[model samples]
Target chain A: MLSVESLSCRYGGVVALRQISLTIAAGEFVALIGANGAGKTTLLRAISGLTPPYEGRVIFNGQPIERASCAQIVRAGIAHCPEERKIWPHITVQEHLRLGAFGRKDTKEVARDIDRVYAIFPKVLERRKQVCGTLSGGEQQMVAIGRALMSRPKLLMLDEPNLGLAPLVVEQVIDVIRAIHRDGTSILMVEQSAALALPHADRAFVLENGSIAKQGRARDLLQDPDVKRAYLGEEKQGRLIQDPLAKDPLATTR
Target chain B: MLDLLPQFVFNGLLIGMSYALVAIGMTMIFGIMNIANFAHGEFYMLGGCITYFIAAKLNAPYLVAVPVSVAVVTGLGFLLERVVFRQLRLKSAMSSVLATIGLGLILQNGALIFFGPQPQAIPTSFSAFPLQLGPIFTTEARLFAVAVTAATLVLMYVFLNHTLYGTAMRATFQQTEAAALVAIPIDRMRGITFALGAGLAALGGALLGAIFFVQPAMGATESLKAFIVVILGGLGSIPGSIVGGIFLGVAESLGTVVSSAYKDAIGFVLVIIIMLYRPDGLFKKS
Candidate 1:
């Protein structure tokens, strides 16, 4: 379980996240839905200790980890598969998984965990010897997820897992996400698509302008009028609308 | 010219071995920390000086002195990383470079004060007679240097490719933030890498000291050659450094055949032309 209290972060003078508080219970699936620059990625980065929070605190499994370095935070059992995937270009898929288990001392279990990841992602297993840079976007995403799982993390924080993928590829990844949740790993996913996220997550929070705008059961928020308008692109009449004339319909209501 | 080719190539390999040793260290530091350590040459100097003090002053055995010199230089390198480079690593890359230049100055001057301004050499345990095999010719010290360097390179390759820490290092070298997220203890990795690099530089200096003078300014020329090798090979690549070193050495040897007076200039001229054509260096795809 993870608890973030009044978290605030900035990029120079620009505020990326402001006074946001949230939590995830053990084995719970939580989705954070927001448009671009809504501080979704910033919040995940702060929690993972990639960028130290400018203000507020994060407590993970009863320990205050706001002051911890990225390595320390990882050792405390949180793995972040960051935005852009950040996979090493020349390294093999198998090496990425091996690096993921860097902190673990148990060789046998590490091998077992790698097998578990391979079982979940047979594509990654097939391309184990291939360089990551040469893999397709969807395969690379699988490798990123597999790499995160190699850490055997207590809580997996994913940033924009569906970003830049085709609908079919997105569906495949969403299936993997669902399977991961069903296996009892707590997950906090940041997404730009409420339709993709809300239907899957048990609990969801809507982030707007660096603040928590709404929080409720995923199903309830799915029907919330404001949530529907801002995220789901649905009319109050319970119908999905697509406007051909509107340029950049996915753009945030800034 | 054909008969003289073997001798030139033999000479090139001997000098190339020392360059390989020094360049490998410089390449390692660049790979992991993303810093061009201007102070690396000073570490090479420190290695020779330490070997001299142990072998000449204390009358220790050659074997004892070499390892001790390496150990001392490595410890100093770790200390430097902790006290100086670690802090600078957080700042701009230029800051680290400037800091290393400053460190190099201090180290060079410190050696001047401690060892005095004399050019010293480790007393060789080998005969002055040139070892000959058909058309090839070399000294015992040169052969020893080449043998030791080859062994060191082999061991280094094993450490980097086969070990857990090495895998972590390679991961860190590739993407530092991601490596940290996997709990690689990046600071420790950097420290170990710095120490290993420094140790190797010292080993190179110790080996070369038998054949050449170990002077305060020796590192100035040696480090320059090492940098040239790194650039020739492609920055931060280990195997590239080795091949680049040999290439540079052979080029220099061959260049001397044409005009001994401008041998160094010949090597530099060739490097510039190669770099202009492929700025990424010989090993890189670009």
Candidate 2:
């Protein structure tokens, strides 16, 4: 559904993404796991047309969309929910949804989809008239997802949906993600949590310094000693903490 | 003293009505575009010219003349937006100010070339008909000006509140990028808003010309007064401009009654005092 070849992104002289290449098949659920500054967000931005790559080709759904405007790319069926959740502060929940469906013209269906989103996220429906700024972290995240869904995107790309939320809320969000995937939307997700993402991701790619370090089925990568040491954190062996906050023991190999 | 009070109030209301029509559109532009439009008064002058040519020379009725003036001025505003303002493309207010200042000079001089520097009065069927309520007297022209301004204001309010485009415009005023992202066609809205503002300014000028006098430089003084009203009203608040205009009209009227020489200065001083006490006007309570 999406292809990237020789993608390199730079912020001034500093390279944020370097010589990256990856692909996602139609209807695939792919998780890209990375440490901080792993070029995950940069990769997403380039594909989503928020940031252009210094050198590369990005083709989605058989069209070269590397030069399309942000709105055009979104209308082309890729919805990007950034990590920070850039919800308009003063606008209401319904207004945010309306904005998400901005470029779309299917009036009746759009209204129906809003209802569907409300059904999926009862909390958002309850506070439909409330301003988005006042919602809790999890509720705001729901609104963000609901907004993306309003676009009726083919690929819903989420960057760190679990950031700064309670574990229970994360579980709730993950469940929503799973349901969204089951309902037939191809998803490309980036997660800091290795184990949680690994179990759900059909195919997983490890991004290190803007390049793919490793790729395989979730289960095989989960069992590899290197993957364990680098991402899984040698937890089963009790040699290192797998926690995201702790330093990985695999740095000795760096 | 009691008998004369009605005269002062009627006169103040007449001036205030003109101020309100012009200032509402100015506030709308400021609120949405954040540009003060230094050439607003020129548009007013253009409106008067259009009205004069249509109603007086072409023998069209006054009712027909008003809309033609508004339409011509609005079209001119749209052309200015597309040719100049849109090219500026999200520039700072200072840039808009400089551009408008230049435009103002051009417009005023252009008026000089075509219409000449002299004032023109409408040659109606009959002239100087007076209406007296007790001892207070007002001309037909002033009374018509007052009535038309109030009617236009009501229409403007309805256009702003009830229409989809109007709501979308309001949304843009609050947050431009967000409004654009929502497919509001922001550039189109901006151009339309500028045209609307210019149209209203022209209408006000035409009205003033009928009741008072018309000249190439007529819009300059009232434009300054309008600026004062906008500031006193608050930068981007429409309702504030109306209240601020009425207050200024009353203050100016009282100053005239007390002493006509210091009246302009007094109106400006009142604005300063109000600003010193409430910087963002009465609307921006937050």
TM-score of each: 0.94, 0.75
Weakest 10 consecutive residues of candidate 2 chain A by summed lDDT: A245-254
* Whole-model Cα lDDT of every candidate shown, in order: 0.86, 0.79
What TM-score does candidate 2 get on C-alpha atoms?
0.75
Q: Every model's Cα RMSD, please? A: 3.4, 6.1
lDDT of 1 by residue, B113-210 (tens): 99988999887567789888889887888888889989999999888777877767877887888888888888999999999999999999998888
What is the DockQ score, from 0 to 1, of model 1? 0.70
Alpha carbon lDDT of residue B147, candidate 1? 90
